[model samples]
Target: MAAQPGGRRGPARGPSKGAAGGQARGQVRRSWLGGVRDAIDGLVRSSPARFAILVFATLVLITTALLSLPLARAGAGTGGTPLYDAFFTAVSTICVTGLTTVDMATHWSPFGNTIIFIGMNVGGMGVLTLASILGLVISRRLGLRAKLMAASDTNPSRVHAGPVSERQAVRLGEVGGLLVTVAVSTLSIEAVIMLGMVPSVMAKGHDFGLSLWYSAYYAVSAFTNTGFNPNPLGPAEFFDDYWFQSLMMLAVFLGSLGFPVIFALLRTWRSPRRWSVHVKLTLTTTIVLWIAGAMTFLVLEYNNPKTYGSFGFVKTFYEAFFMSTMTRSGGFSTIDMADLYGSSLLVTDMLMFVGGGSASTAGGIKVTTLAVLFLAAYAEARGAPAMEAFGRRIPRDILRLAVSVVLWGATIVAVSTVIIAQITKSALDFVLFDVISAFATCGLSTGLTESLPPEGKYVMAATMFMGRVGTVTLAAALAAAQKRQLFRRPEERPIVG
Candidate 1:
């Protein structure tokens, strides 16, 4: 234990040149890593929208890899899931689209199912929502741009709601509270629903483990409005249980309302007057659509024996309501979708087209977009220059955005239908329904999903990704690097009806 270096006993050298050189190289390596990390962080901050899309894409790729693992599957016909099937399922689950090429319970091992569960949770909760939450947990701090990115990505209606999450993130306002509220509110709602669901699931399964798993799975799925039926029998098995159906209905309804509404309601339960106009419009419109869609289904499918002829009036009513509830991005079906009267399919298709609210796990052009467009039309008909809603004047930019989203959505649905129509040669009605479902991120199907060719599956998979990230967001990510125009051409109006 002699002293080192310049100590009298050893008179050791300060350092060897080789050791010094190695230390210098290690420092250089560390510096290089730090530079790479900083560059990535800078890129993400500058283009938060693109970064968010990239993050979701990366997550989808990870999910695809995990699901394709041989260990992730049960010993079925093949040792592992096929590449196409795995890719399709990964996109579906991570997008919370719920479209499945294979049966969930029968085809997937426990590990595979868990992977799906985790992916749905991550996807169902906005990707940026999870990212910001993780950042908060790890560093106890987050950037303004990061919060603004989450706000825009989740709530398209708030795309121009500048610095809402940012300012709030600094002062522990709604956006700041959102980081915790997202996780708490989600689990809280799911837990209550799960608890209520257990006895019913248990009665049906007669095994505690089976019931618990089903309860937890359904709680997560329903609250996310993903409508995944892990039940081997499919969701139809619970059709007779009034209590189970009621709980599910509530979960799907609330989940589709989106986090902003949920948080507002939770924060100011008694102050309905203080609720944001977004929440007010969303609730009113949702209730109206639900009732309207339910009545249409009840009238058209009431006597269709395959769908609801045997059910009593009350049961039929439940099924009708459930059907309508599901079409708003919840994919569960109490009866076969194909057996529904053609008129009912049309109704469901329209409902899917006008999906749930912005910032919700639900997808489509979004309820707000439709409401804005219709409101603008009404105002224009009356000769009012501007659209008004809930005593707030709608901005012109928002109108432009709404129009863009609707047109973009319509174009996608039309193109997708044409492509799949040729590939499957399925009936136009069925093809249109499935195409809209894929684009809306609504997992409803016409029994044609499994039969689609590889080409068609890939088409649907890409559509699902676009729907989840938003067509506009995808377009933005790709075009964001372009320089903004500093001048504009003279305006001109084209003739219209």
Candidate 2:
């Protein structure tokens, strides 16, 4: 009608503000997405180390949010978890570190526990390795770059600027197999362990349904080296359950061996000579530490009535061995850590500091680092030009990397320990023990973690984050912050003690 009135001309129209606004919004959205895609590509291509740290940090944030929900607290829908407790628990869970600022068994609802269970499993899988596996699942094939990124998890040098040597624990060609191995081994090991613990859990007066749940939880916790106890009595309920204890110890040993070592062992079980240097060193060093730690604990705690004094010879040996396994980042503890002799605590600190194998679920500087340092010392004692192990020579770069990891880990622990001690004014023994436990991702505590002030808890959470992300990975990320230099500086030897 209006058009007809205007003689075939429409009435004057308004500016197409809605259309223009929509178009502008679309452009902005596209630009933001494009920027994100480009950044992700750069991250995946140039530095998987950075990508890994980013992933863990993201998971921490997400888990924190989930744990902070009102439903996450036990017996309460109205009262939400404290941000401090939620954040600390989130860090500990995602890091697969067992240190907690709250009561794990009684404090959280089933929803919170489920979140923790999922977080530990995801965190236990190496970050870069998980990315590669996801890539494979999505595309049905892993690209060369993806393989390189996955390899970097097993061997940090893959992310550094240099030609990758053929003498690797996992060759580039075998990366696809390694990915399969990681997924399969994690599932199979946890499943088998879960089934084995069902009987023991049932013996504890839990119904079949409850037993299954507890069994599965313990299996995951043990395999992930996360010592979170779902039972109200803690490990004390299962203290005398030999079958459960043995299975837990076995699971922890296997977990601490690292996925690369596990893969290698699976392939070369029948031929030890064919095992990679990494596998050999990890196994040998792990065995040595296990035995030595047990003996040290047995000797130191045998007379302490507060600890092993009440136990007979066999029980004392068993508990000592169990604690030794836990110190290798297993985190499970049946006795009061405060009752341990100071000397025993120092030994635990050392073992925890050494932690587990490279790329393992356990934390600390890693068993491989300890192995490498020892190998280097032995070589130096013999005046060899390079560190040698299992008939293979380790590169100087690896040795330097080991030193860097140790230094980085020690610095983190030292700084956190000082800050926490200052905050709580606690005894150095207890402070140092919990700090190392946090740094090693070992859950053993002198009851110090829960008593710490909020500031101290925050410090411990940061320590757990750094520990689980790994000192080696952190060093690699920091190294990647600067481009590789084309020029070299003159070398000078400095005298040292």
Candidate 3:
């Protein structure tokens, strides 16, 4: 959930710099574990998507094992950590879905919290993506077969085996180096956000160490969109300060924009035109949703005393904006969602279903999916031959993929809602919100999470796991080995939607 080299034939080479950390370079031989890892590596190189799913399953198992330990659970609640509870918590945290059966602050020890932190940090990107990035960083290369499987060069690729041109070497370097920049950028932003949020804790008179820990935990959580607040007292404690609120909002905003967008923008700081079309579509859709969702919340919750009504205009506006931002898989809420108006809940459900951008810490159908769906509709209505957005033509195959993702996501959410409603005896709307939150990996709950039964919790864990891995990825895995058709079938017109 992890870094550099120095080379050769220089000066008097004082005992060699690579060995300066006390361990000799290449002193340790590969273990039996490395053989197991190599087998897994070969599997990953063979089928990145399928292997990525396997890796996530394996991580969840590892996380569950750690959580089931006696110390991972508190000595307080329910006497002992139930296997289901530990398993559910592991899934939620590893999926970066904040649904929890026990109160995180009360139930988990520092060791447990650290485990959750590691999970969120690694799970911010899909497991396969993380593995690919790590493979590049540690090995300084990715397999050529893996490269061809990738939809973007941002996904790592292997260095060629034979003689290479200078320009090709530079390109290869950038491909591998992108992972480093992504890692560095994530840590740096989180650090700044932690600092920005620190003074708020100090103002509350919390001890320095506790404040630092809280600040760090939340910075990681917020940026990863896990939204698992570590404070025992909840938002009423340290987060009462407006400055901290703004910083947290900004952190969530950046995190949900997707890593590739951030990397491109960071690397090419000033050039708007140089940004990729994917980046442009993501940013534009994100911005539009943020503003529109904020406005919708303000309009709907304006008079609801339980939410923004009591705060008055200026404060309410900010709160609304924050809530709206949080809705795009931000997962944190300043007000009681249970108390919000039905209309507000409906709006929130929609936003949670929409989720954040692709390749982001956020979940849901993804803003790009929505953009593609809408653009395809526009193209169809105009009788145009292609779907175009921001002057780039979107392939018909992409449109089909987008529709499949949305439909699959919606189907999962709908089924889960019914199951949860039956188990929890919650109303349909409330259950729908919870289910959609789980499905989108948004983690926002309407006070129903903790009240759900063990079975209910398991249902959510399954939904979160699938959502985090992606409905499309899961569907593809399940529908493995697409058989090639030997003969073309006749096309038939079907009834319209």
Full-model lDDT, candidate 2: 0.86
The residue pairs that clash in candidate 2, if any, are none
Residue 237 alpha-carbon offset, candidate 2, angstroms: 0.4
Candidate 3 — worst ten consecutive residues by lDDT sum?
Answer: 155-164
Off by over 4 Å in 3: 1-38, 75-80, 134-140, 148-174, 238-240
- The weakest ten consecutive residues by lDDT in model 2 span 6-15
> Which residue runs of candidate 1 sit more than 4 Å off their true CA positions?
1-33, 76-78, 131-140, 157-173, 481-488
Residues 1-497 of candidate 3: C-alpha lDDT, one tens digit per residue = 11013334344466656566445424333445467667767765555667667868888999999988877776645344788888988888888888778888878887788899888888886554675665555445566543332223222111111222211112433544555655787899899999987889878888999889989988988888888989877665744588888888888898888776787788776988777667888889999999999999989888887877777698878888999999998888877789988888999999999988776788898898899899988998999999887677776766777888889998998888888888888788889988898988888888898887788888989999988888766765565555568999899999977
Instruction: Give the C-alpha miss distance for residue 235 in model 3, angstroms.
Output: 2.1
Please, what are the lDDT tens digits per residue for candidate 2 over residues 218-319?
898999999999988877899999999999999999999998999999988999989888888889889999999999999999999999998999999999
- Candidates in order, TM-scores: namely 0.91, 0.91, 0.87
Candidate 3 Cα deviation (angstroms), residue 368: 0.4
TM-score, candidate number 1: 0.91
Off by over 4 Å in 2: 1-37, 134-141, 161-163, 480-491
Model 3 lDDT, full chain set: 0.77
Model 1 Cα displacement at 233 (Å)?
Answer: 0.9
